[model samples]
Target: MKKQSLVKGAFVLTLAAFITKVLVFSNSIVLSRVLGPEGIGLKKMVMPFMGLMMTLTTIGLPVAISRLVAEADAQGNRGKVKKILVISLVITGSLSIFVVSLSIFSGKYLSSFFLTDPRSYNSFMAMIPIIPIGAVSGVLKGYFRGRQTMNPIAFAQVFEQIVRVCLTYILVQRLVPLGIEYAAAGAVLCSVLGEACSLIFFIVMFKISHHRKMKISRPSWSQAFRGKNVLIELLQTGLPTTGNGFVISITRAVQPIVITKSLALAGVSSALITKQYGMLTGFVMPLLFLPGFINQSLGATLVPAISEANAQNNLRLIKRRLNQAIRVALIVGVPSTLLLYLYAHELMTAVYHAPTAAPLLKLIAPFFLLNYLQSPLQSVLVGMGQAKTAMFNNILARCTNVALIYPLASNPLLGINGVILAISVGVILETILHYSSVVKSIGYALDIPNIIKILVAGIAMGYIGRALFINLNNLTSQGGATLILLTGIVFSIFIYMLLLFFLKVINGSDIVRIPFVGKMLGKIFPK
Candidate 1:
């Protein structure tokens, strides 16, 4: 990991994330078409709980490792860095052994008890092997983040996604006729294979680099004598985070169960329940979070950037960075939310061939707009060393959201829509809490005028874009609604860009923050 500036590192990581999402989204489209809603449901039924598995497997050590390593590296203690890594391996490896063993032994009973569908049992079992692959990778990833190295991890993620996409296509096709259960299992196994490949990549990279690419003292094993002290430190630092994450994971895992049971209480049949859940989780979620790449990129860089600023007591720099990140998020995300809302039905029809998801998408888009913007603010908290506060906030939001689901979703009139309403409420609550916390910590100010500017530009773009789509769809008769929708999307985005410059929501300083081409763009796009 070379010492790179925040913009350059974020650029590389964001590009990789973009490619990975494209691949994953494309793969999901293929799988949804092949597996249909119920089949997708079967696969998704086991995925949420995988978060719980991961929280157990890594015990949140990745965060601790990254933080500890960053502190040591700042002190120029290369020997200490290596000792931390060595100790981390011992700890993560031990946890992996125990988690994997326990998973293998209890897979059947656990699946039987938890999953509403028995058909998901095979997929559940198939996914168990990923716990270990994920553990070591998490440690290495944390190490690289601490080192501020983005390329290796970025390259590994895209590579993993590519492999997963290809294997899923081939394997699911071959297995579909056997049964949806087997197909789901095959897809799950494909993910396992992809993760294994990532593990291999990490292992090879670690060995080849030996993490010695920098000027550092020789690797230290003397910590082996005091491994107990290290272990205590690791656990002390990580356990609270692990507990918070475990609660969040459990909250996520329990949601589908709660949603399913509540829907049943609303008198929905089991089959339709599966279909709606599949559509919500598998289809709409992937589409809605499509704009998350921008927020995620900003958040990744925001953390270390703010951390650096805070280290020097540079409150101005921290506030400036926060403003810029939120500005970028709003500029991109508000328009996305508007366009998605305007074209929700067309998008659902075009992407998933399931227009039934249109209402769900439109209903959830506003909430998700807040969701996208919340990332950077949460990162602000983490960067400010208020991670525990942020964790508790998340815990509260999720539990409150879960608590609301049963009451609303059990209503016969609301049904699954009630579940959406519940979570959308959670998003609003979480965003508010995050914003308030950030304000209290740093006196951060929202760019209210610029937000108005984005909304102004986005609303105009959405309306014009929707109008264009309507005209083109009406004019064409050769099944060209999709082509029309794509064209309108392009046209709307062009107009939105022009309006942004006109309204000054974006300016030369923002352009100058671009990774490689900043200076050039800044010259033409002056503030």
Candidate 2:
């Protein structure tokens, strides 16, 4: 397999991500409409625990394996690469089995003790087997990434999402007739099967690719056990990388517990509480985070590009990339923030048929421009070898988030709105800390005038789009609400771009990246 260049690989991964996100979003819409918010809540109730279990299962092995394998492969030490794989598999494999076992035996006890809804036991058990399969898959994905082979990994991702969504929808439809619990459990079971399929795909690809490239003599169990140096190297690289995810997963696991307990104390019924939780996570979050695809795609470009620049001690280049990253993030973020804020009700109703989530969406929308920038800023930090700084900052913010959930949510007046407040504030804190760290480290000043211009452009576009939508809303039939909403958002984003282009907020290079017309536009546009 020929390795892809950095740009080509990012393109492959970004395209795959776009496809998978679409599938995931469509799946969410279907589930929300079919199983309703409470069903989503039930499925989501186990997801945090699953995330924590997965974090423990991998234990930084995949990242470790990626780094170690790349180093060994670069040095032409095939034997060391093989050893790294075996050790990582051994470490993660054992952890996976342990997680699977723990979940199996303790499923009832856990759901009863930890969850506010003990009825989630079925969904919990249904998702247990996925731990082992997903852990192995992560290791393989790391191997592929280490080798710079994006195609197979990209294919496997899209394949798994397609399989998961289609299977889950079919299964949920069949099981919803029984009960929401059954539907949720069936959805989880389908996810497990989908992961199994991805693992199998990875295994086949690895075998074929590995055998064709080079033959490796199988090491004895004693030889594998003797890789003390390899284990240390893997642990050293993997642990620090794992820290960020560890914090995130732990915080996620803490959320439902805190919010549910608090809401229950406020005399909110369990069912309504679940529905509200479902509305927030399943509906509101997916929509808000949809625009993050831009940040993620650009962030991928930033890490390697900035990392290379830093290695050369080219501070000027680093400054340029950092500013460009922030600019791009805001370029996507501002319009997205306004779209969600201005059309929250129409969007919620049109997309998910869950209008009740609109308020949460509206409340959180204003703060999300900063939220979207976190990824790009964090990428810059990672490029500068300041990942731990970013991690600790995230830890502090999440701690604040968790601390606020209980106190605010337990107040009947605040309720789930309080939960949104907690989340938005945490996002603000994290992004601000990230921005300040980058600016302080690089002595980089943002393009204040350009940023102001972009903000003014975005604000102007937002009000115009809202007025257009309202006018069209009165003219359009009720059945065409989805179409109208979709059209409105697309036109609004286009308008925002035009405003930027006219205001000179974005330059020729920005327009030059568009697919077909970028060159023509760039040639015509001024610097």
Candidate 3:
């Protein structure tokens, strides 16, 4: 594809991604308010199961389909595309039914094993029927992504979030008055509804696209379906990344079990545990992840591009694209990290109305940056066929996390903070290990000098932000903490960009690469 086509495609997809993220973010705020800590905590308790189900149902299928389609197109074997899609459909559909059945029969036991409160059992049971919808949707979405037809995929994302949020808000608001457990279950019910809507949307788009393509050259369904090549191709590309997805899901599942058991050992009340978990992971971490929507949007675009280049043995293009992705990640990651560090408390107080969440946000801010870097970087590595190294690093990190969390939280001095600290340490270790592997494999450093320059700029911005907010807090009594924080955030962003431009930290070429920065940079710099 031409550079123009690539840019246009990425832009449309990114817009869809950003919009969907905004919708999800808005729902996060709404859910937090309606559910509070207990309701949120209940949801968090069940997250691991949901994550695991998602991984099993969709993880390998999407990766396999997208790669097979892209690879087939590159090799001029158009017949393989349809074959891969059909095989993916059959495989994923079968897995979805099996997984849903397993969940239905075993959800109560799974709930008891993970969640101490048996009341969450029904919620787990409720999530079963929705699994198949999500499973099939994942395959269709990947097929579209492979074709580089991203608009439909993007719209489906937005549609899913809208449906989920609207339904959950009504259910939770009405049912919370009845009880928190019911309210919590209502939230899980939203997932079922969202998945159904998304599946329908994907089917519609896939048919339309497939219909147009079929008119030009039709291959017999039997001919497309009979080839053994489809199975081999999907397994070859998809299996390695499947481990990465499973590890992530499993690690997330372990978190609640670890934290809850540890807190119990410390004699903390169950009620308090729920609140603390909600405050830390729910309200705080999500805020820290707000910037990730941007990184992920870019990452989705980079995957196919990187995969295609690598398939054709285009090393120079791979490096160029990798560097470009890293640069973009740094530009957003550095400033976003500093901004969170500087104003975490103020931001939390403004949004969640929970002053206690401020400190938790501070503890979790570094991980946000680490994740923002690691997520896309890891995807790039996998695209480059380095999934084995990525898998090893993640496993090592999770193991280290499990070992350290227990001992650290057991210490009387650290208490609850120890758990948060453990997560940060584990994340730092994971990032280092992943970076080391990438550096060794690629034989290049991560541009340390450029990284330092960006970090310095970000720190300078943070300092200015702290000073402005400190003063603003002293002066404001009307709009309260939220307004003061908002003012500081706006001022800090403006000042940061002005400094970056003046210092030539972001040059002409870099300016043109960003989504909207080009037009603004043109006005300010006057090309």
lDDT of 3 at 412: 62
Clashes of each: 0, 0, 0
Cα TM-score per model: 0.82, 0.75, 0.80
Cα deviation of 456, candidate 1, in Å? 2.3
- lDDT assessment of candidate 2: 0.80
The C-alpha RMSD of each candidate to the native structure, in angstroms, is: 4.4, 5.2, 4.7
Best by lDDT: 1
Name the runs in model 1 displaced over 4 angstroms: 25-51, 75-80, 107-130, 165-193, 203-237, 260-279, 411-416, 473-478, 508-527
Which residue pairs come into collision in candidate 1?
A: none
Per-residue accuracy of model 3 over 108-149 as CA lDDT, tens digit each: 787777688777886787777777787778777777766666
What local lDDT score does residue 45 receive in model 2, on the 0 to 100 scale? 90
Candidate 1 C-alpha error for residue 496, in Å: 1.3
Task: Arrange candidates, best TM-score first.
Answer: 1, 3, 2
Between candidates 1 and 3, name the one with more favorable lDDT: 1
Q: Which stretches in model 3 have alpha-carbon errors above 4 Å?
A: 1-14, 25-50, 101-129, 165-193, 207-211, 214-226, 260-278, 353-360, 474-479, 505-527
TM-score of 2: 0.75
Better of 1 and 3 by TM-score: 1
Who is ahead in TM-score, 2 or 3? 3
Go through the candidates in order and give each one's C-alpha lDDT: 0.81, 0.80, 0.74
Encode model 2's per-residue lDDT on 314-407: one tens digit a residue: 8998887777767767877888888889888988888899888899999988987788678878877766667668778889999999999988
